[model samples]
Target: MVGAEESGRLVTVGRRFEVVRNRPLLTLAVGHMTVDMYAGLLPMMYPLLAGKFALDLKTVGMVALAYGAGSSLSQPLFGWLADRHGTRYIGLALSWTAITFALLGFVPNFAVLVALAALSGIGSGAYHPMGALNASAVISEARRNSAMSIYTTGGTLGIATGPLIGVLTLGAFGLHGTIFMLIPGLLIAVVLLFEMRAIALRPRRTGGSPRLVPPPVPIGPISVVVGVMMLRAWSVFGLQAFIPIWYASMGYEPSFYGLLATTLVLANVIGAIGAGHLADRFGRRILIVGSTILSVPALLLFAQFPGSIAFVTAAAIGLLAASTTPLLLVTAQQLMVGRAGMASGLVLGLGFVMGAIGVPILGAVGDAHGIQNAMRLLALIAAASASVAAFLPSEELVRQFANRNSNALPAASLPTASS
Candidate 1:
């Protein structure tokens, strides 16, 4: 019943809001890339450190454990802090991360090395929740998936490229060569500081004080989303833990492992960007369900086949499996509308913890029952996750969140993208 002129005006307004809201997110994505690059450093350096310290498997694992404890376990706490306080210090946190991880090559003893890794982990943990919150806040509800996907892709790209960087740096200058890597982190941190300051200059509505009270909303849908994420993580980490070992057992060179990993990860980056763009038009739930359903078969194909076919299936699995993550994050933020920091922390941070836990469990199963059987189990988990995706919140609930009271809300109270 609206007039044609009024409709055109409304359309123009929508477009303008979309452009303004999404402009800040690209800067945040770069910061995400810089922070995640540090995560890849540990994996690349592990071999050198193990050889240098004469570390047994147990000792090596302990070093990983130290990093994991700080990075994985503390994310939720940081998320709460960001939501309750403010994300103004995210740039500073990145600088902290740069300093800690860059000092890796200078540690004098194994204990010192472990301590530094833990400190670096803490810095990494502090960066994600705030970064995610800022990304969500700066974008409109409809564009959330696309924006987040772009952000996620940056991290994936950084992680994929990090091994190459590490190899070149260490090969040229030995262990102490890590000092050079600090420059990028510091540079990125400075950029983020300026970007965040510019964002602050814009006028914005303020949010409520942080409280201990639980969010007053239906918990069922959020729980289902979290469960789906955890299941996905289990499969992902299982593959990450064993893929290189599987290739080695087949007599492939170590560099082949890196090649395969880079291919899968790059494929993931592509999928994330593509899926995000598609989800904005096609709807998030369908994209998530369809991708997850397809990934089970892709994973099975990868495990059952070998050689080039295996690489193809691995790419497919990575594409489908990895793309759903940003979608899941957007969904969680939608469900807990005002708690973007907490939602981001829960989905991204907790998912990492779950993946870390899954590695050893999957490793044990592989040892006991054979890696093939273990891969079969991962396919089953993927299938289960796909099944669970069917029960997300109804369309009506999603619509209410998106359309009702949209403009009157504070930035944090705005409904998230993805139903």
Candidate 2:
């Protein structure tokens, strides 16, 4: 039988664990779904909006960049908010942000539309870190990677499905006709936001407890992980930006492109789960580096062959490229100890910015040079970023930190080493 003192310690630790993540994982999952669904609406609107404004490729790229900017720029503020008030407020804010974007589709002017697009992006910025915080609160060290992989796949699916939505809406509504379609998504968001209220009044358990979490992992290793994500994002965003054009030019029907995209997204769903499990058994750093290295060849090969082979290669590239996402994030979180929000934001905010910037750069390149050149450059990013992942230390930094902390190691001695 356990002694009282040991039992008390267990209770304290259990309670702290409870408070950190007493909320349902489903809640976090639903939150991810709601926020990401906003991205699904973008591609559907892009063609219609471009025709309406008589915009060129560059202008349209700028419009896409505007949304990315909102998603990027708002990270620090949301990260800080998550750090302070907990993620519920951030989640609530993001939900409303989605609602605004839904309505923003109704506005007419191009400039106003851009502004609303940015605002909508800002709202979306909250979903990731906020959802991550909630997930981390509940996820123990063992299952975090898998849970995150599952959650992130939602975003990939939304992005993949967006073009279909846009096409269908165009067929039905004729450009602006789909503006009203956003209302239902907005209403869904409002309903989900209500769940936050219960999560808030639940109770706090982390206060005044003996520190049981491990030592902080090194920022350098985490930075390396973030760098890998930047490259992955670049490749994903670049292809996503131009693939529809490429497919059309290849003499494929829109339906064929749609089917190809759906296959790629499905590959992502499988890749994320498989990668998470791989990260668990082998190591995060190894999986990240390996995925990166393999993806480069896959992407380059795909670029060289732009028809059926490219479709097959794109799925292979996507699987390897996206597999690293959760591992990178999990590495960052371990590095930060209790600070899931900031660690997550650092990668996501920075990577998304890099990816967003890549859109305009590649757009201009596609205009000036050609789409092939744009794709080639993105493949380079995949290679370079993956090479960097080799340097990140993986071996359960959380355990490393917690082990060191238990020993009451000197502050100067505990330098957040990941190995």
lDDT of 2: 0.67
| Range of the 10 consecutive residues with the lowest summed lDDT in candidate 1 | 410-419
TM of each candidate vs. truth? 0.82, 0.82
lDDT of each structure? 0.73, 0.67
Off by over 4 Å in 2: 1-23, 103-107, 180-184, 198-217, 249-253, 396-419
The TM-score obtained by model 1 is 0.82
lDDT of 2 at 254: 60
Query: Can you list the residue pairs that collide in candidate 1?
Result: none
Against the correct fold, how does model 2 do in TM-score? 0.82
lDDT tens digits by residue: candidate 2, 253-355: 6667656665566677779878876766677777777888888788788778887776788789778876776777777776665455777777788788777
